[model samples]
Target: MTSASELLALRSELTGSLVLPGDDAYEAARTPWNLSVDQRPAAIAEPADIADLQAILRTATAAGLGVTVQPNGHGANGDLSGVVLIRPKRFDLLAVDEQARVLRAGAGVNWGRALERLDGTGLVALAGSNPEVNVVALAIAGGQSMFSRRYGITARSIISVEFVDAAGTVHRVSDADDAELMWALRGGGGLFGIVTEIELALYPGDAIFGGGLMFPAEVAEAVVTAAFELARDEPELGLDVGMMHFPDAPQAPPHLRGRTVATVALVHVGDEATGRAFADRIVAVAEPISDTLTSFTIGSLAAVAAEPVEPMPSADFGVALDGLDDAFAREFVDAFTRGAARGLTRCGIRAMGGAIADELGAEFAAVGATQADALMSCSVLLFDPTIDVDAAFAPMRDLAARYPGGATLPTFLSSGATLADAYDRDVLDRLAAVKQRVDPGGVIRSNRPLG
Candidate 1:
């Protein structure tokens, strides 16, 4: 425990946003997206620079206090007791080198900043399902998206990184330097340290077409079949699709605003003419009540999906499957739709693997071939903050077991309190070894292991 006097002196030494127990913003500062997760840290430090982070690290260690560093509160898990919460919201910096086809963003930067920075460059970075999520945290957690079938998971797109370690030392990790740490940090979350900055491989694209298309629930089987057939051919054309069942919530779109339904969110990452033509092919199968399928630059793409930005309690868990065949699609949708009506779950199945399964043979690979190009990512989402998480996840787990694809991507994983159940043997072993080396004292333990 830090002494009151020590906390006071430490506050004076830091040059950044600092919130103590008595501060009005302290409670808000400790609140994460999961309303159930409440941290009562000795102090919440939003460091202005790397030096400020180093000082906080040394002080916290000396005081026998742990530190929980988060870019955005979306992915935070487990308790943060007797700790100093370090948030890097002040370190927002993004630089794009168009010629090099890479983007460098600071820890504080989010998708909003990345989109703004990538404008006019005719380049698009690997973005998550929702653009409101943090860029670095998502990248490290093995990011996946509807476009993943073409570009591959987000972690494979990283070229280099700058992170601060447990001892306050900052190191640049890349294939050319510190191979082991680079491999570990890629998909291991923030176990090694707080990533200060990252460079991601970008693709040239002034315009790409993609958006949500809602269909009547009755045609789900036909929709899944047509989509699979389209996936077989259109992958070379940068096509990706998702079929999701949303609850009859008020927040849903008017056409899909209520009643159980399967909405297909599709994307074509090519020229405008080709994208529109492909979209026409989709609309040919079944008329969509609401369609946002149109060509747009990366900067304006977020509007294509129109995701919410405010923080709320959420549970995200998924598994890959062989394929979305008619029989399987009908059964899967029926099970989930029935569950959703009872206020048990909201599920989505994202078609995976095309150009994404091409295998770059990069240092950090996400979901090996044995795992990729299977079918779709089957996941459940729930909003009840007090929902019984373990019980809620059980049905999904059983459903995943019925499918053949093994190993769930780490980024889509939530509440993985158990190591063995959370990861397969290979990943579990590698992650455990990396944790041992980087955080030897086990000082960094969150939902995922630090050591």
Candidate 2:
């Protein structure tokens, strides 16, 4: 075991910023984006190089201190008491192989930077709905996206991964080599190892047709009704629709921007003519107050959804359904618009299927429990961090209970305590076994519910 002196010696070997428990920067280093999470880790280590990461890992393992790694601290697992954190501010390696159609990035890189770097290359990675989120954390957590219907989850596009194991060893994992670890890394979150860098398959994103369409609140029901009908037959169009409610204010646009109204953001990753035609059909159902559906690059797609750029206290709840019927679609629209208190909620239901549901014939599983219904993911956010979480979650619990069938999205499950609540028993059991085999001492615990 590493003594305090030995730990100090190991720390001296690193050239990156290291924050100990009582250091001034320690508090900032340990804190996550979600203000509700308050973890007092033993130390926060930022490794400047792969060798430095190896040293930290070895020291932590010898010290018997659990390790928790995060790229940008978006969705940390749980309280990190008595553990150490590996923040990747120092590991910012990015490489793009155009011939291979893949881009490799260090785990610490943010989505916006990656998108900016890959711009004009005719290649784009599967970024999160929000740009500020980290690439590695999102992929490890099995991210969902605006283009999920066409490309599947972020993990599916991963071509290779480089991580440091619990034993303080480095390993490179790919589909052709170390296939088991590759499969586990896809949707397993961070149960197995701490990823240093990951290689992902990039898609051509020169000019994809995608943007938001604003509709009047008066016809939210009719608009959603027609949208559900269009989604049913046009599964091949790679379309995604998100329903939003914006408060009436001068800060919003002149059209439907300032009004507390319903809006849908649509993206058709096809030719401009075909995409514009689909938009025309959608608008025909209900004349929208404003329509901005136009051609855009993949990097700019984040603006269409326009999710908050700043970090805030956020809570998410979801339901996966068996089928999409008019009754269910109407119910979904009503909950976000008519049912919400003051109509102050921003809700979206991504009609997931098509390419995502294709038979990949891999042991790695997909959260496909709902084969009959459309998957509805709901997120509720409060700009102020001081709001009481219990009060905020009360309405969401009620909403989940009111759904046609009650089930949470695995990716949206916020707490480590709710892992089983998100995933089924069989999936949880398999993850537990894999965790046991890889980290026998449970040395790599985080805000994850692997129990």
Root-mean-square deviation per candidate: 3.0, 3.3
Model 2: per-residue Cα lDDT over 1-451, one tens digit each: 4445556677788888668866788778888876656777778888888788778777877887778887677767567776778888767888888778888889888887887777778776777757788888777766766666666667778778888888877888787876666766777777787788998888766667867776777777777777767777676444444465443545345664435455666677768887888777768878877677778776676676566776555565555555556775566565565434433345666666666566674355434322323555555455545545455445445555555444444566645545576567777777777788778877776556565
Candidate 2: which pairs clash?
77-447, 78-447, 248-258, 321-373, 322-372, 322-373, 323-372, 323-373
lDDT by candidate, in order shown? 0.68, 0.68
- Give me the runs in candidate 1 sitting further than 4 Å from their true place: 1-5, 236-257, 362-370, 373-396, 417-422, 445-447
lDDT, candidate 2, at 83? 79
Single out the weakest 10-residue window by summed lDDT for candidate 2: 364-373
Would you list the clashing residue pairs of candidate 1?
A: 253-257
Q: Tens-digit lDDT track for model 1 on 113-227? A: 7887787888888786466778888888777755666677777788899987778888888888876777776677776776789989998677678787777777766665666
TM-score of each: 0.89, 0.87
